[model samples]
Target chain A: MSCRPHWISPRWMISALSLCLLVLAVTALMLGPAALSVRQVCQACCHAVRGQAEYDPVTRIVLTTRLPRILLAMTVGAGLAMSGLAAQTLLRNSLASPYVIGVSNGAAVGAVAAMFLVGKWIPFGAVPVLSAASGLMVTATVFLFAQRGRNFGHSLLLTGIAISAFCSALTAGALYLAGERLQTLVFWLMGGLWQATWSDVLIMLPLMSICLIGMLLLAPAMNVALAGQRSARDLGVNVRRLQSLLLFFLAVTTAVAVSRTGVIGFVGLIVPHLLRLTIGADHRGLVPASALGGALLLLTADTIARTAAAPVEIPVGILTALVGAPTFLWMLQYRAGGRAGV
Target chain B: MILRAEGVRFGYHIDQPVLRGITLELCPGRVTALLGPNGCGKSTLLRCLNTSLRPQGGRILLDDRDVMAMAPREIARHIAVVPQDTPTDVPFTVRQMIMLGRYAHWDTWGQEIADDRCVIQRCLERMDITSLAGRLFSELSGGERQRVILARALAQQGTVLLLDEPTSHLDIAHQLEFYRMVRELATEGQAVLMVCHDIFVAPMFVDVAILMVDGNLLSCGSADKVLSEQNIAAAYGVRAQISRTGEASFQAQFK
Candidate 1:
């Protein structure tokens, strides 16, 4: 596990990513439309803690707007990436991101359907709950398919595509019935922290911590899992329990992230995939590294999304996809064929 | 640990069982080869014995306790397995690869305890793979990879070892060396049940042979007695002349 030099090892990767996260958070807090100097950022923090006054607009913006947005981005990003790593391990598929495996699509289906058609009858919480249910269904379907082991190629991806397509169609049908709400659904599906608030951070933090802890606990088994499923089981992993628990957590975490921030694509895939290559593949380290890597990646993407073209903000999802979609293409050609560890 | 399968039955489909009520016991210090032609269900039977597959009919017992009812860790403490193929692309150095065998023995946090490291070292050295410890498992040649996988299984320190044709893909020299290692382990008081189709080569190294045909146990006894030419023809549908080359050793020439 300590194969790499200390500088490049998984522990180092986690350290590097954590350092990057701190720097990026501060920078993100400073670089918005109303530029806040370091002094202003400091004042904003102090003012936030002291609850002294709604001082100048600069501190006000930093404290009220950028802080919550950045926090949400990191938490959701960490959540998705951890879930993504867990899903990849559980499914034993390199391409198994929440988006690729239809978990995100399932969440979208639940959110859109609930928002449009069932809103009157259901409580406000139905969207997230329904999204998790649908996500679980999609995940369970793929899990069963994989267990039957038509694995090691595009078959699993194809199944995901089919289920995701069905989910998307259902969403579209719901939107068709409620045509006026189409804009909102489209915006949510595009995914952003555009409306980020303190409440969103509060909602996402506990889930992120849970994902991190769950992933860390599952990390060692996940390391053995890299040996492949049958080997893992024979090596004393309860493969059934490991796979199902991973899928359950993956679906829940991904569904919650999607519900909170809509559907931010590729954090899960790119973060874990990149971390494994750069640091190493031992999950004990990969789990924490991916969490930090996801936070760093998404926060950076978000910073650029806000500042790249000032007043007209780009959705963070757009920024992530700008890199993610190409990475997915590269993986489709490379890691899919390089499906040795899966 | 003595592993015994009694009246074990399994099938992907109910009407066509892959292991049909087969009963067998593996004794300590014996290297047993489960032999048959392709699709004769030796591999399936091994899977059932390990509780990776639950037999449809009877029970797999480890020291008389039902394997299916025990936890995987509980079963693995006594039974380790080497499958026919491991994912070669597993991105770990040989040391890390072998460290995974300690998964069943770890506490919740799973830090490698001092005792675990000692076992890993012994397994690595015993497999003659100490020199390859720093190399990635995926970078090894086929024979080296098999040796690494064997060392990993040995790290489990189980009394019973199950393998499924672990050397079928290796060259003849490597195949012989692999079985020699298995024989050595068996001599050290481990009960080994290996599923292999090297009918010609297997009989030379194994202590006993369990011949199977279409999911039924055809014969089980000393290799010389069970792998008789007639039984070979019956189990594998092949004509062969099995000659006892030496005391308790054999060579098979296919017709």
Candidate 2:
């Protein structure tokens, strides 16, 4: 579809998205199970910053529980969206996502196995490392196998689907065998931020920061690459190297996010696609915009999951899919209508 | 710079060659039309010359240096290719698409500088697509998209421009406009080699015509000398009538 002349520029779009994210982040911290007011949240934040112990339950809940969860959601959301942007560009398929390419499932399998074998002994920190390794291996295998022909995008997607199915089956079998740990395994697989701590944020912040910066720095090459492999080559892009590097980073971002949050779907797919439609597909704008848009989306979704049922929290992943699937369908319909010259 | 392909050989399979011992030289300020029947090696040879496809046997030299030794970006600084079909799935605006041509000149992070923007503007004006600068590339008509692609190639500022069947999707008027742009580019000191299927239309715009059949060059000369009835029959397996319409134009009627 043609781009309508909206008064908003790319810079304006980024600023707006960042503002939305800020508002959403503050709201998420303020409204949770304990339901602290804005003043209490701000006061708690200030006291925590100044290293004072007020010893109030409201401040404790606000600083210790809600703040880490909010930060984790923001970081995971940004990481997934950036990964999805890279995946879509690298595969040249808008349908591609971190979950679609089997990396999330691979990480899920690794995280599940780590949960059974090492989650008790090595604690929560070791799961992401193990999952990142496994996810990287799976992504590399898919790349090697599907890189044979001219239509690599289609082939890569197909290979990823196959691997994803296999990984999902393995994860299911692990869940079945988990027995007493079934609730924990199922909770992780459905995706929740309940286990998030400052330690998890420590692991997520640096990894997501590196991957996000890498995606932005490589945005120009990725822009040229949208012209397809042959044109990208003629335009001076080393297509193979660019694809490899982008895919590597995509796997890393997806792996780290999934291992920490446990198989959150649709954030990676929906955020980039939605941002591309609204702002056009210039990766220079798309990457950062997707980052902000993604943080806003997941923050909003996780807040709803935390507050919608109140005493009972629905998994964030279910809410995202429920929202993302219909939006994705509408996107497909719009694209089809556009192609029909309507 | 002079682009010379010497004894180049290539094939999809080992035993069957698509291009066999092909040799040609393209000089600046000349427009050369490559004409051949379907399944001939015209497009293959063009790809080899541009370093998109590597020849197993010979060397392609640009200004007496081997192009294979150069990095892809280095080669791209001297050669630009307008592919048969441009990707429409990406939602890049026309101006942004044209700016992508400056990729070779960009530094490590590949940010577009002020000069790159100026070049993009110049190319857009040169191609007469300034009015469509804000339009999405996917939303443009076939002709507008083709011109935008040409503008991108011009923005590359390469000495050699290679086009593969550029008019396959254009109407007759757009095709004429396309070739006129090519002629203008060549006159401004770029070597233009285009694979064209229209025998009658190509002779009107190009300075030289190269005919290929069965992976061999059958004729390489002025259009009047190369599009003779005998050469057409031998290369295309058809009877043809050739008539000189003007000083630099000829009509070929195949029967």
Candidate 3:
């Protein structure tokens, strides 16, 4: 029920986040490694549809490569961030992340097995879809294992940690044995936008869309879940089923992003935490805002990585880790100080 | 109006029973204070009433319909609860906080109907929290937050309101204010069941008191009849001095 003036409620925060996301998206599309003016970008985008011979190669690059990259960055970042947000809420731990708590690690193991282990049975890239499928499988396994009893937190986090350790060890062993292909494998682990193309974006779009809509549908449930399991169940939430469903959705989103981005850490960890400071902990606000914030952060980081040294590109993941870790530390300090005062 | 529990038994595991064979009917339009020391099945029994905790051996009925047979949302439509230490980790505005009570009635997409909005506004007004509506829930003082939670339960507009120790920690003024609000709700024919620790305050405020001991309902009747020295000592293991404060009113003090 509406208890206050409509003007003073959460609608304003939602609209505010929406406006920020739009501005960030436009900025991302207009500015990048190739550098296109807004007018030029628009004209190029407009004329390219009809096979016009008017726009330059730079324009084509923006239309065909960078725009899709930006969309993928936003959607994937959003998915990962929302997953992280849901995980944090579900586990009741501010430090929880799809990656840090092992969901991404599990996915990585799955993907790596698909690449290295599955390759023993098939030709190289013969099962091109193996890594993604494997990632989903691992994520599902981790989710199921984490949701057995009342100790959802310990079960999920501990299982994730174990899975991550196992995956990391296997990945290390695979890298050690690969020899000549180690460079390519290392780059995949470091994470970059070098592989981003229209096809990759097409592959990711449907899954990302489904995950985003699913998170939005569960926004209220996430809100209730934040009140803790007992209270949430009392409030008519089927806590066990809702938790499992959330875990499945989170893992799928995490696995997809990991399969593409190779475990970009802070998009999941930092983005949602940052949004929580301004928007509070309402998942309805946090999920969408985290998506927008993650996309904007990653795209901007990627754009800077490409242009900072102009010919030698820095990996996008490293740049975010550089920025994100300190911000996370500051939040920890702020919260600690707040608690001290109390 | 009729709250019935027939042969109720519960346990986390099958072999161990936390509650065994509890049969009682809670009468309507009265304030029933459930009293016992910790882990005496006070919370367990309350949870069963709303199907938050499933009954292992028996059934709970609300208006002749089995409680477990009804959907959780349907039960929520009739029974609103204020749980212990409801945390506000997020800074939802007071209005947003109270509107969560309307969640059961909300659509799948969480759309707020006009009637829902009206009920929220009325509850906020009733709780005298109209001024606090714009404040972040996390920013409120503990007493203020408690009132907002009470307002949220009121917004559910349930005839049976269940509160677990609604005023466990409060200043004297705030504690008295909470019961005053509870009395008002009861006057409107809502069945108010509250778990209380302050033996003196509950009997003073409630019409009926349910004293429980070792997961058993030891006595249930009007506060004056049920909260005698013998019953209070049996349930709480405390020596008490009972004094008549007014006609049909008594206060208890420790020796």
Tens digits of per-residue lDDT for model 1, B1-255: 799999999998878878878999999999999988899898889989988887889988888888899998878888999999998878788899999999999988888889998998899899998988887788788999999988988998889999999997899999989999999999999999999887777778888889899989889988888889899888777899866767866777899
Tens-place lDDT per residue, model 1, A158-268, is 777888899889877877886788888888888988888888788789978987887788888989988987899899998777766777778778877887778888888
lDDT of 1 at A322: 99
For model 1 the local lDDT of residue B140 reads 84
TM-score of 1: 0.91
**Which residue runs of candidate 3 sit more than 4 Å off their true CA positions?**
A1-40, A51-64, A117-120, A123-128, A176-178, A326-342, B238-245, B251-255
Chain A, model 3: TM: 0.87
lDDT of 2 by residue, A108-187 (tens): 88888888877457876687788878888888888888898567777788899999899999998998899999998888
Candidates 1 onward: DockQ, in order: 0.60, 0.60, 0.37
> Candidate 1, after superposition: displacement of residue B215 in Å?
2.6
How good is model 2 by TM-score? 0.93
Docking class of 3: acceptable
State the displacement of the C-alpha of residue A178, model 2, in Å, after optimal TM-score superposition: 4.3
Model 3 Cα lDDT, one tens digit per residue, B102-141: 7777778776789988998898899898989887676678
**DockQ of candidate 3?**
0.37
* Pairs with steric clashes in candidate 2: none
lDDT of 1 at A225: 86
lDDT rank order = 2, 1, 3
lDDT per residue (tens digit) for residues A34-119 in model 3: 67787877777777766772457866777677777777777777788888887887778777887755656665555555666544
DockQ of 2: 0.60
Residue A227 in model 1: lDDT = 91
Global local distance difference test of model 1: 0.83
